[model samples]
Target: MTMQIRFEMPSDEALLLKDMAERFVADHYSLAQRSRMLAAPATELPAHWPRMADLGWLGAALPEACGGLGLSPQQVLPLIEVLGAGLVLEPVTPATLQCATVIARLLPEDRASDVLAPILAGQQIEVLVAGPDGMEPAVSARPVPGGWELSGTVRLVPGGAAAAAFWVAVDIDGAAVLRVPAAEAEVTAYRLLDGQAAASVCFDGVLCPPDACWTGARAALDAGAEMALFGALAETSGLVAALLRATLDHVKLREQFGRPIGRFQTVQHRLADMYICREEVRSMVQLAAEAMAGEASDKRRRLLSAAKVKTGDCARAVVRDAIQFHGGMGMTDELAVGHMVKRLLVLGQAGGTRAGHLTAFSAAS
Candidate 1:
């Protein structure tokens, strides 16, 4: 059965993107392909960078002059969800679009075009900057002579070691986008629990020159948080789908007593509950994306926090139920469901834990 979620009715551009993503998944996300990539030393990204760039997806949130699709959030969420469904590991979503937006706004008009062009083209990788742990975008940087020196580490920096550059945050000093040179910065990279690349970026006085240092730390922080939340939600959605699909398949195939488990009333009820949880979380994510695309600053902040809380709740419960429904296999790595559970557990706290988001929402109100 086709699931009906609020985001099903996305903008025309978003619909076009959905079509592209559908084709990409059908062609590239076969079980064999995913298994092969998983067996590789690192999670696979494929050539999604250049190919997605050609589709104008890598730059969907940037300006036309900057080599972007210049698309809005309403036009981008569907694409992101498609990426999530496939569990693709490309660094394009937050690394490029989210980070590029801040750089475009903070950097000189002339320079933004140059800096953002490579990002859109998938030639350069940028990291989302944030700081002050327990808060959104937790990390801090400082300005030094000739350039800004990024201090404190952005733990679990996505593609941190692999990324060619970064946009880091530093306390009330505001946010500054630093073009961190790989050769110059010391990076410790590893695969995250979900098979995504993560690293601890240490800057022993890494210089972010004036031209290279972009401002507007607060605004950037907000945007980055929203991007991150969306990523978490998308990932959670994929996991939820996997859990529900597996449950449905199990009920139809497995037998209890003399009949199929699917005929069991209790089993049917459990599956229905699972579907409800998934749909509710999906709706929250769509509303969050739409709210982010809105113009009101206060409203946007409030909506994001609400979305985070709702997503966290539904995701946590869905995975737990999936575990219970699957019995012992749910906790084993031999089963892909376990990985989804772990990822959702992490997502619940990534952007901000439920309590943290609640407090932030309260304070904002």
Candidate 2:
């Protein structure tokens, strides 16, 4: 008996958005531009953030009532994949998707419109500061006269330096979330190895009104983490795919033994292995996205962790092989592969490490 392997096709809208993202990246986002942005002073988002808002990409996963497209997470994966391939340095996952989801889902109805409107309009940037592995809250909150006072430090917040506001996870009796204006905290910003900016924010007696605090923050944080993981997986899949393409192109042009290196059986096998890894990661990403859209919370958490582990392992493998195939040029700044390898390394550590996710998956089981 013969078995067939099937791949799910994206929806028509997703296909359209994917094409738009590709064209946008090809026209506006390039390796040279990425390099320039990385070298620039860290502030909030790129100037193209407004353009992304104009294209409706910022609100792709938000509800229509909140000025978003009301699309599911699966529909937004294609755009994320394209952004990843371009190595765009925007904080789509940690800021737009994750923070937006938390605000939309957990914030009070009256406050949602106030927060989500500006964000969806690209007038504000917000970064989520949740603890890793769902452990203890990184920040703590105490009740004050009119509201809550937050005190603690949140480390390694993606895009935190440039954010206009922060969604901080705090323990006030239990897990709670607070929206603290960036001006209220001390932000120590630095760039990651991949040229992305992050920060350590210290909230020293920052006062937030009662309306700024949201209850049931644990569930919201879990959901936000899952969403962020899905976005990261999509981006990593794109990065792996781009690496494979670059490696193939390099092998085809670079001569070894008076012929293209790609003609060698050993080189061909290595390229094939890289391709297989990319495909596996891509499939797992899609599965996780689908689960996030439909599955129950417990099931979604398990699937997201499973996807993160698989994606991280495959990403490391693919990046390592791609670098090896590129010879000495792979590690140089002149080539994009070296930069991609750096991004993959960061992604592996983001959200949760592979070993950590595997442990989470096991515990869940």
Candidate 3:
């Protein structure tokens, strides 16, 4: 009875979105642009932020009334590939996929707009800090007379440096999920290896009002977290594609011996293996996306965990082989290959490590 999803074709809307995204990447993004952004990765704001909002990408997952396409995680999944391939650093996974999803799904219609509207308009950047398992243990929240007080610091918040606010949660006995304004916490900004701005936020007894807590959403945190995990998996799929393309081009060129190195049997075998890995990742990603979009079940959880493991292992192996094929240039920032590898490394560990995801897969099975 498990794994009954039929192989379906992409809908018109999904195809159109992919076409539009391809055009956007062609027109707006480049390796040189990524280099400039990489230099200033401590700030989450990108020059194309407004453009992404204008295209409704930031709100792509929210409901139609909320100025979005009401796209499910599976429907909007193609956009993640585009962002990853272009090396765009706009926090799509954190803001669009995670926080925006939680706000739209959990908050009342009236209140959801307050957070989602600004994000859709590119006026505010909100992110989630819920850990791999429900809530991060580093943060502690205790009930108070007026509301609640939160202490401790979370060392890593992807895209948190420029986050206008954070949808934070603590692993405690109650509905601890709530929004905290950036000013209320001390945010030390920095850059991730992937050139995305990040922060370590220290919340010293930050007071959270009763209205701020998402008590009803406490139980559904896992769903939101899974959506983000699926996004990472999708992005890594895109990165694998990029690495394959880059490696192919390099092999075709850069002559060695008397002819191109690509003519060598050993190089050809590696290329064939990389292509197979890419196809495997593509198939696994689709299955995982389908499973995640279905009703909540142990089957869905196991599929997602399997996907994380597959994508993570494949990304590492292929990227390593790609660097070897590219010679020394593969590790240099001058080439897109190296940057894509770095992103693959970071995203490969987005939800969980290979061993960790394997454990999850086993538990779910």
Candidate 2 positional error at 141, Å:
1.5
Cα lDDT listed for each candidate: 0.68, 0.82, 0.81
Residue pairs in steric clash, candidate 1? 130-137, 130-139, 131-137, 131-138, 131-139, 132-139, 140-170, 141-170, 175-217
lDDT of 1 by residue, 157-178 (tens): 7656467776666553554455
Q: How many residue pairs clash in each candidate?
A: 9, 2, 0
Which TM-score value belongs to model 1?
A: 0.87
Candidate 2 per-residue C-alpha lDDT over 131-207 given as tens digits, one digit per residue, 9 for 90 to 100: 76433478888888999888888777887878999888888777788888999999998888988888889998899
The residue pairs that clash in candidate 2, if any, are 43-162, 44-162
The reply for model 1, stretches above 4 Å from the true place, is 1-8, 39-47, 132-144, 171-173, 332-335
Ranking by lDDT: 2, 3, 1
